[model samples]
Target: MQIRKKIYWSLCVLLLAACRQSPPPSRPNPVLQLREMGQLATTEYELSKVVRARDEATWYKIGERRMLVSCRARIKAGIDLSQIRDIDIQAQGDKISIKLPAPQILTFSIPPENIRVVYSDVGLFRTPFSQAETNAIMQQAEKQIRRQADSLNMLQKAQEGAAVFVRNFFEQAGYKEVTITYRYQENAS
Candidate 1:
């Protein structure tokens, strides 16, 4: 009886341990949407000069010059600007690393002159409203236009900057043909 009781208790303990639930599996990182365009190719050149002297008595000296040639290639791509959460760049002798900048929420006001308001009745039916209403409408329109302009400007700047960066990277790396692939990825919220 004693042995049977011990065995029963052991079995109960083992069953309880086996029945205990385990923690849930972890989730994988979200996938990002990336777009890559065509490639732009260019050549880069770098020159270095070194001077050397021969035997002291001979007084002979020689100058050595080296030309490092490289090419810069760019791949264009589109990305959701809103999803971009961060931008970073890492450059080595012959390699470059780029990342999107952190997402920023910006707000601005518009001016009255830029706003255009059209009314069904223009001549006399047009409500002779107070200056404040007119100003507000104009300001809103101006703001929208300005925002669009700003977005375009930013895109242009980014493209220009990317080109320059690729050129410089190739020149510094002493590579004759350097290819850069621009990739855009959207971050998950």
Candidate 2:
């Protein structure tokens, strides 16, 4: 009985030890990959433009509906740092040359809270504007803002800022001479 008790206790201890294993390694968070790679987006243009869009439709030449919405869209244009590869950053002695991605619009926002309705018109014969109609106006307003993006010089500004950013970044890495150039792409704006 004493040998049997000792054998059962040993088996129980062994079973408990077998059930315990080392914890698995933690995975790296994908959201922090860019930061881990030392790449940072440098937005140089935060342009706010007020746009006006008019939607009109005529039915049977006797009924017509027209809508004009004036709103402001905030545009942020910059280069995506995540596109940078290790090969793009070439450092030879004190000089560093980096080929950066083309500048693009990072974010376009027209917050409902920020959009002020300057004027809303409904013709006498036309019905009041529905939710769909209002949403359409906002979308049109966004398009107008995009069309005027070049006129606002956002692309140039973003590229210039990105160059400065990369130069500064390399400078911190002990590079004295920094040359930053953009990799041109077709239809890039």
Candidate 3:
């Protein structure tokens, strides 16, 4: 009877081991493809120049009609430049286009017609610096830039985490084709 009990216990242990699930098989990471819709051109225009009224009794209209002018200029100028023309995302034979809304002027303190100008001089240092020091500084900056780029990549993965998981699961299940489309919502004013 003891030997029979020992054999029964051994059989139970074997059955338990056999019923246990094996660890899931690992696979190579998926590569993401990013495509740019078009180059975003930045255009700046000087809306107006205005003069400030120091005294409260001044007869000048508080907010008067202003002249509006627009001309093509380099993006480096300090002007009111705000616009995003085109953006698109594509993945696994599916494409999604993102449309950015127009920017609105939230607040303005300067009068429309008065001429108020402010300028600052930007000077470059004439003294020569060592190449080694410059290279070191650039290396540090490059490291920081790479870290930011990695963070952005991680954020993109997180944003598409569910889709990625689904795709991976389907692939593991022997499905060949899977696609996802993402759309942007326009803001209501």
Candidate 4:
């Protein structure tokens, strides 16, 4: 009877331990995930322009030099996810709201393969356009593209793309409704 009582108590203890509930799994914060995404490239713009440079005739040089280059510039625009602050995200049950930073140009490049000397003219006494001169003209074109980014609507399209991405991401993360908005900016790239 003594052995029986000991065995019965041990069985009761084992059953209670097995039936105890474990803590529910914690959900990861979505805002942290977004910040970890860093720069999100949402749109790319390919622009082609013809740039011209001219050297007027000097009394000593006796002639003029002119060159025209056709170059293609690529611009990437997106929102910087790492800029998201804690206050930028709000979660309430199945709904989530996010305030993203204004979109900007993340990268600009003029690939060498996309540049060509479309035209050149040099007087008999003038020196031809050198590689250095051509490079300078290409740089000028790049700056012009940067200045015209706003007119091309690059940032606006980037913002729209980012909104779509956020909505899809949250919906897949079990959020029933997602609202995305951007902060105001004095100037955008």
Q: Compare the candidates by TM-score and give the number of the best one.
A: 4
- Residue 106 displacement (Å), model 3: 25
Give TM per candidate: 0.27, 0.61, 0.20, 0.72
Q: Which residues of candidate 2, in runs, are more than 4 Å off?
A: 1-40, 44-68, 123-125, 185-189
Q: How many steric overlaps are in each model, in order? A: 13, 0, 7, 0
Q: Write the number of the candidate with greater TM-score, choosing between 1 and 3.
A: 1
Best by lDDT: 4
lDDT of 3 by residue, 48-86 (tens): 222221212335534222222211111111111133333
lDDT of 2 at 186: 28
Q: Cα deviation of 50 in candidate 4 (Å)?
A: 0.5
TM-score of candidate 2 to 2 decimals: 0.61
User: What residue pairs clash in candidate 3, if any at all?
Assistant: 49-114, 49-115, 50-114, 50-115, 50-116, 51-114, 51-115
Residue 163 displacement (Å), model 2: 0.4
State the lDDT of candidate 2 residue by residue for 133-173, as single tens digits. 77877777777667776687777888888898778888998
Q: Candidate 4: TM-score?
A: 0.72
User: By lDDT, is 1 or 2 better?
Assistant: 2
What's the lDDT for residue 118 in model 3?
Answer: 32
Query: Where does candidate 2 have its weakest 10-residue lDDT segment?
Result: 32-41
Between candidates 1 and 3, the one scoring higher on lDDT is: 1
Where model 1 places Cα greater than 4 Å from the true spot, the runs are 1-90, 100-127, 139-189
Question: Residue 93: error of model 3 in Å?
Answer: 39
